[model samples]
Target chain A: MNPTACILVIGNEILSGRTQDVNVQYIARRLAELGITLAEVRIIPDRRPVIVDTIVAARAAFDHVFTTGGIGPTHDDITAPCVAEAFGLPWVIHPETFRLLEAHFPQGEFNAARQRMATLPQGAVPIPNPVSSAPGFSIGNVHVLAGVPRIMRAMFEELAPSLRHGTPVASQSWHALGLYEGALAAGLTDIQERFPGLDIGSYPFRRPDGRGGVTLVSKGLDPAQVRAAADAVQALIAQLGCTPIEGEPPP
Target chain B: MNPTACILVIGNEILSGRTQDVNVQYIARRLAELGITLAEVRIIPDRRPVIVDTIVAARAAFDHVFTTGGIGPTHDDITAPCVAEAFGLPWVIHPETFRLLEAHFPQGEFNAARQRMATLPQGAVPIPNPVSSAPGFSIGNVHVLAGVPRIMRAMFEELAPSLRHGTPVASQSWHALGLYEGALAAGLTDIQERFPGLDIGSYPFRRPDGRGGVTLVSKGLDPAQVRAAADAVQALIAQLGCTPIEGEPPP
Candidate 1:
């Protein structure tokens, strides 16, 4: 089975327009690069019950589940306990995390609020935060991360080396400015049939003057199949009387 | 009670980083302006079982649930039937929608693929798509919208008039230089207690010299409360011997 994963973005600030979420795209792209299929992403509020329910549901469904946000030092930062409850683990302060946090800010009292960041579920491993001392946690297949894009990227980079990767994923696309989707449907369908594993997407674009066109995307793990199907799509577009401009090759 | 809602963004393209899901921010900002608190946002893939389970879960949790993506004319567009299955509604094409779609395409075979966009749950009311001919649908309190940002925004604008709004939302913030969150914890907590309904967020900004300062944000529907809390935060920052700068008001 291709390792499928799901991401849960937990924060009301994100859904409330109080904060914009840029982490989803970053995590998704990184996961795809590592040959992990990011199957789903969920954004929920800071509510405990909702967060717990989503984590439980997503973890059961996907091979690996990742979460972002609500792991901060505030009243709304309830992700630790919620995730702990979801996995039936004990919520407690991890000694190693506490020491790391203490070393970072040794001059003052740790305080009840700041200490909240050190709490993790029983048997959960801490994902080191290079930017901030507060760490992320991983329980089984679920990797809980921070909401800040900078922190999230750092956490993912630290976590990536340990995760199991399948085939490296890649994608390619072809575009034409003067053709309609209906005009190329027959040919595109033939290309799609020839390369069953490649995901084919046709996005139609209409100009200000109502001129029509479509961009066909071919994505998969097999580089040979992707290139072959993309070439077929381009050739097919040429036969339809429209010169195809190939977009950026898949990375 | 204040009206509230949540958006569920479903697609592998979004999770895989192939497509940036702009729908969440669009819906969130729109909902916030309409005085509808967006409680959560979730992104799931095109899997039928996952979609069905999420729809049912979100429906049970929020007053109104809006879903974007997976309603297009493709094989991955499984949202329509999954939604129908979740609510136990029969999935079929509404006649009026078919007429509108046929009118736009005019002389072509509507075909099985194009016809797929016309299918929705029985008893579902069509949401008018001002931008595209393909219609969105509303069943009970759940509104199923297209995933494309331009299409989703247009469809939401059509549905906005019918939604029950409470109070128009507003927000304000205070910025300060050369102070860390640790430096103003006590005062920030005091501001929190003074404006219990308002949501306050502290964003730490690192200056060029490796020194950081915190930007305190106060948000709520009540402008007076926002102003009062913001003033208090500024005054508190000034007391810390840090220069307080007034931040721009929310747009």
Candidate 2:
């Protein structure tokens, strides 16, 4: 069975609609490639009680819980403290992190705020950030990463090797222009019933230039089953008098 | 008090990381303009029990619950039935929706899948879709809309006036190039302490071209308090010897 994961995005900027989140999609794709099922994603404000409660709950519910944002040196960066509270562990500065950060910053410049970045929950292991000096950390099932895209990507790479991977989940899709979803829904349902383990989805797309199409997708851990389902989808498109095109349509 | 709202995005494409969601940000921005506090956003798959449970919980917790996706004519479109189960209402065909859909489709083309779009829960009031003929519905506080952005935007615009709005929340931000977050964290915390009512946030941005900066933001219902906090942020930027930019930097 594939490991299940949840992403908790703790930030006021995302909730306030002041910032667009790109982290969730990036992490979701990576987790998929690593054979983990991305079960749920929650975006919440940077409230202390909310953060602590959510961390406690999510850590128990999924095999892995990735938290992004609220780990900066600013006053609003309360994720580290909240995580410590969640695990009933003391928040302390890691010796290695402190050393690395202190050396990275200029003399007399590593203030209390900068020092906060080096602090982690007890028994936590650091995930080094290649883009930035300060590191992210992992405590138990919860992996904490920075909010910045570049730093977050680097931190994820550092921690990816430690994660347990199942059979890599993959998908195949076929699209046919001018083929409407309602026209192919019945035949698609038959294909889905045949392959109960696979997730067969039918999506209808409409472009701004009035061009539209229907894309049928099949996804599962087994590549053979996924491809067989896609073959059925391709046949269905042909049966409906629309030429089946492999993969997504033109942008 | 502001009426709190939660968004439930129901789809497989989003969870699979196959689609990058633009709907959540659009709805969030609209809710902010209408003075609604977007407390939470949850992205979940098109599962029956999960959708039913989430709808029940979110409806009870917040003043408004907005759901996007799974209202189309495909087999994956299970949101209508799940919502019916959530409310414990019979999944019935609304007479008005049935008539509109029947009139919209050509002769002999409104199949079972197409007809599914018209089948709403009992006591559902239709929210018209200007982009397409099929209407979304509002049953209780849960407003179910389409997954497609163009259609969803039109539906939200139609339903916007009906929603209860509070004092419009606003925000002001000042950014500074080459200003690190650690340098201004203490001063920003002091500013936050002075204006306890406002949410003052410090964000660090890194560009691909190697130019990095910090953006300080203040947000609240009262424009005066928001502006006052932003003024303090600008002063802090100047004290650090970086030019205080009036707003977000260029993309």
TM-score of each: 0.85, 0.98
Candidate 1 residue pairs in backbone clash: A41-B43, A42-B43, A43-B41, A43-B42
Weakest 10 consecutive residues of candidate 2 chain B by summed lDDT: B242-251
Question: DockQ for model 2?
Answer: 0.82
Residue pairs of candidate 2 with colliding backbone atoms? none
- CA-based DockQ, model 1: 0.44
Q: Which stretches of candidate 1 lie over 4 Å from their true place?
A: A85-93, A109-113, A185-198, A205-212, A249-251, B84-93, B106-119, B190-198, B205-212, B220-228, B246-251
Model 1, range B177-241, lDDT digits (tens) per residue? 77666567667777888788887777666655766667788788898998998888889988999
The numbered model that scores best in lDDT is: 2
At residue B209, candidate 1 shows an lDDT of: 75
lDDT of 2 by residue, A62-179 (tens): 9999999998999999999999999999999999999999999999999999999999998999999887788889999999999987789889989999998888886998987898
DockQ of each: 0.44, 0.82
lDDT of each: 0.81, 0.91
Candidate 2, residues B14-62, lDDT tens digits: the string is 8888888888889988888999999999999988998999999999999
Question: How far is B49's C-alpha from truth in model 1 (Å)?
Answer: 3.4
Compared with the true structure, model 2 gives a TM-score of 0.98
